[model samples]
Target chain A: GAGVSQSPRYKVAKRGQDVALRCDPISGHVSLFWYQQALGQGPEFLTYFQNEAQLDKSGLPSDRFFAERPEGSVSTLKIQRTQQEDSAVYLCASSLGDGSSTDTQYFGPGTRLTVL
Target chain B: DQQVKQNSPSLSVQEGRISILNCDYTNSMFDYFLWYKKYPAEGPTFLISISSIKDKNEDGRFTVFLNKSAKHLSLHIVPSQPGDSAVYFCAASRNQFYFGTGTSLTVIP
Candidate 1:
């Protein structure tokens, strides 16, 4: 089976520009998650979705970050105003069942966003 | 303040030696612990996980040990191979997830 996947493997955006990142979860996965990975650092959680409903978004860094999963399978992470600090790799993950800590998360290749 | 911390930035070991990566946490609420391996330009790949109830979990050459009292956990790889060289992340969870800075491991063949 195909694993989780993300689009725009690499992106360079001018400061203050808006950027939309896409994620394709594994077929039939019930849970989706977004994370940001800074250089030389591990990924930091951003938001989580169970189906089309976002269950937890406490990890979102700021108001500029918005995420959605209208169809439960595909998800998007949008940054309203890009900043040099927003430069990082955006990763997406999916799980088989409910969005629980016990469930194993499978990750995608990720989108490296560089805000200039 | 970061809840999870991997103090070591990098480590190197021979292919036949053991590689130990450590993680510490300040929160006692974390009930589940996980280890992930990542490569450059790629997302993290789940390696193994352990529940707070158990002290150890092993999968092939990889073993994870948890110490609730110390609020710490460690991952050990026996007879490390060149392919095993990658960045390892430590994650702890109760209802939400918290990740460490990650430790890069290099195995020389």
Candidate 2:
């Protein structure tokens, strides 16, 4: 079975540039999530999707962050006007259920985004 | 505020010995807990999990313990192996997930 996967293993952007990271969830995953991990720190929640519908996005750092899971299988996290603080690894995970089940989340390799 | 915390930044244990990693959380609403392991240049892989209803759950040599009243959680690996060396993360979730800073475990053979 294919695991969750993120594109462009690494990305470098100018401070004011916009960048988009992509995630491909498992074939039948119902729940998807995005998290940002800073160096020497834990991963912080960013947003969540329950089959194309954005659910909890309380963890997004600011208005510059946006996520969408249009087809419910693939998702994208877009950041506008990248900041130096946005330099970190963007992780995506997917689970078999809508989160009510004990199904463990499968994480993607992550895309390291660096803002210069 | 850090809702989930792993106070120990690192730990070293001899192979074939018991290794314990601890975690604490400030939130009581967390109903599910999970442990993840990661190597450099890779994403975290789920190791084990325990629900609020269960006090303990075991899988092979990996065991997870949960204490609701104490707001504490821990993972114990019996006869830890050298291959077990990696960063372990503690996570709690209900609707969203909160993760700990992670503990680096080194198993010396």
DockQ of each: 0.84, 0.71
The TM-score of candidate 2 is 0.97
Best by lDDT: 1
Which residues of candidate 2, in runs, are more than 4 Å off?
none
lDDT of each: 0.94, 0.94
Candidate 2's docking class is medium
> Which candidate has the top score in TM-score?
1
Write candidate 1's Cα lDDT for A1-116 as tens digits.
69999999999999999999999999999999999988877788899999999999998999999999999999999999899999999999999999788999999999999998
Per-residue lDDT of candidate 2, residues B1-109 (tens digit): 9999999999999999999999999999998999999999889999999999999999999999999999999999998999999999999987778899999999999
Residue clash pairs of candidate 1? none
Which residues of candidate 1, in runs, are more than 4 Å off?
Answer: none
- Looking at model 2 chain B, report the run of 10 residues with the lowest lDDT sum: B90-99
lDDT of 2 by residue, A66-102 (tens): 9999988899999999999999999999999876537
TM-scores of the candidates are: 0.98, 0.97
